[model samples]
Target: MFHAVAKGTPYSWANRYCYTGMFCWWGSTTYRRANSPGAAVDTGWGLKFFE
Candidate 1:
């Protein structure tokens, strides 16, 4: 499993790092310009599976 977070809605910068095995795992984060639109920042996380 993986997780992530962002700073702004109209994000300006973002990044993530992950690893995999029977299941996939990752970590991520994001940033946005001081002045932007939408919701101030955006963020998300996900998981992956391998056979």
Candidate 2:
């Protein structure tokens, strides 16, 4: 269902590394500490890291 929502369309940046890495990193941090600050803000940080 997630894959279907993020189908491999050309403009699907989320289907690409931008969102992929963000969520992956987010999960990593959340796994370490669920109450981590700026987790949501880190999405933009992760996107910059990937790019």
Candidate 3:
């Protein structure tokens, strides 16, 4: 997360690093562009780090 802050992370940037099992035990992501007119993706789930 610190890397995102340092690089002025863009919207949906983190989505690329997203994985089914990552460094976290459970995680989620939401997509939305600031000041943009469109529907934001609200799909997220509590997945495990290892399947």
Candidate 4:
């Protein structure tokens, strides 16, 4: 999905997660529909999620 978006005509990258947090505590992250590839997209806190 990420590759396709990056290569598609619009030419964009995908953000795997959105920033959700409090003053110093990070909360849940939401996936972005379309973000740019090789772009500086931050998912936050170096956290990992599994299905």
Choose the strongest candidate by TM-score: 1
Q: Report the error of model 3 at residue 36, Å.
A: 1.3
Q: Candidate 3: TM-score? A: 0.21
Q: Work out the TM-score per prediction.
A: 0.23, 0.13, 0.21, 0.19
Model 2 per-residue lDDT tens digits across residues 1-51: 123223456655455532332223322232233556745433122212221
Candidate 3, residue 39: Cα displacement in angstroms equals 1.9
Candidate 1 lDDT score at position 16? 44
Give lDDT: candidate 3, residue 39: 67
In order, how many clashes per candidate? 5, 0, 0, 4
**If the candidates were sorted by their TM-score against the true structure, best first, what order would they fall in?**
1, 3, 4, 2
Q: What is each predicted model's overall lDDT from 0 to 1?
A: 0.48, 0.33, 0.45, 0.39
RMSD to the native, candidate 4?
12.2
lDDT sort, best first: 1, 3, 4, 2
Worst 10 residues of 4 by lDDT: 1-10
Residue 11 lDDT in candidate 4 = 48
Worst 10 residues of 2 by lDDT: 42-51
lDDT tens digits by residue: candidate 3, 4-48? 222355556543443343445354765456666766555465533
Best by lDDT: 1
- At residue 41, candidate 4 shows an lDDT of 43
lDDT of 4: 0.39
